[model samples]
Target chain A: MDNLNVLDIFKALSNETRLNILRWLREPEKNFPAQQAHLPKEVSIEGGVCVGDIQEKVNLSQSTVSHYLSLMQKAGLLEAVRYGQWTYYRRNEETLAKITKFINEEI
Target chain B: MDNLNVLDIFKALSNETRLNILRWLREPEKNFPAQQAHLPKEVSIEGGVCVGDIQEKVNLSQSTVSHYLSLMQKAGLLEAVRYGQWTYYRRNEETLAKITKFINEEI
Candidate 1:
């Protein structure tokens, strides 16, 4: 991984909607409903929180939540997995550790 | 500190100018020139990197750089100090740790 600016990481995290999505993923069972047809099973596992459950919690249109998740994933904040007709998202622990070390040593 | 959204922090850090300012702060000696008028001594200390040096490195107007630094500081990414006629800024370690932990545990 390249040198990641603290500001860049912060910027990616600055949105209310995006923040809620991340928080919801922390406890998938409590925050999300059971997986439906459009949901992925790993929404409760390692892969990620299912897109449909995320959409429901954020109360946004499916497309908008999807876009926001994509942005965070692109910035190395979230990881995505596809299964059947659904996509699941989860935090990337490696990047999380790197960000912590970066802030500790560089910032 | 309240729960911080990863996206909110990321959004604050996304700008190229803000990113460069942070990078320069990592090694104040090599990145900034000798402090001149309107520059603070803590550009080399725990207090922070001077505003003028940040202005010079980012190649932005004084007002713009000042605003950007203030925004990051507001978001709990940077800490600012006002001394004499200059302002110096440094990262806020507490907030940084919080952010890293939030990403690890929540995201």
Candidate 2:
């Protein structure tokens, strides 16, 4: 729960788009495709939701979503995995917990 | 711990200055005046850390610190109180807890 680290985590979650992306990841099937026919089902499941599905749900261009995901991943709020042509993203629960505890202890 | 509300809190803490302000508030006596001779001790105590003290620690202009405080207060991260000529601020623990829980459950 270092003060500087907590600040970094909070800075990461500050954006409206990144915050929404994390929320959407909570229920991937509802907010994102469970399977994309063009992509292998196993790939989607093993890798998590693809960037295209996230882009569509977020109503942003593929480049924009990709950028946002990269930023969040750098901030340690998300984990990225690639399966062939598509990239999938999921919330980083460990960092998420650390962030929550940091806020509780430091703030 | 609504998503929008959590977003607001995160946005408030996103700034380096505002984040430092919260950390300073954690140990008021060390970072701020215990009493100002020009002002009432009770006023400083009940009202919390004066804007001037915060300005000094943050190394920002009076107007800038005032603006930052106003923004954080609006985002529910701080509580402000005025007594006589000076205003003081304190962290809003309830909102802090809500934010922590929101991240744990939603993020």
Best by lDDT: 2
Q: RMSD to native for every prediction?
A: 4.0, 2.7
Displacement of the residue B93 alpha carbon in candidate 1, Å: 2.9
lDDT of 1 by residue, B1-107 (tens): 46544454566667878766776776666777774445445444463677877887788898998889988888777888777766788877677788667766656
DockQ score of each predicted structure, in the order shown: 0.50, 0.72
Candidate 2 on A14-106: residue-level lDDT in tens? Answer: 788888888888777677765554565444554367788888888888788899898888888889887678777888877887876677776
Q: Give the TM-score between model 1's chain B and the true chain B.
A: 0.80
Please give the range of 10 consecutive residues that has the lowest summed lDDT in model 1 chain B: B35-44
lDDT of 2 at B39: 67
Give the per-residue Cα lDDT of candidate 1 at B76. 76
In model 1, the Cα lDDT at residue A28 comes to 67
- Stretch of 10 with least lDDT, candidate 2 chain B: B38-47
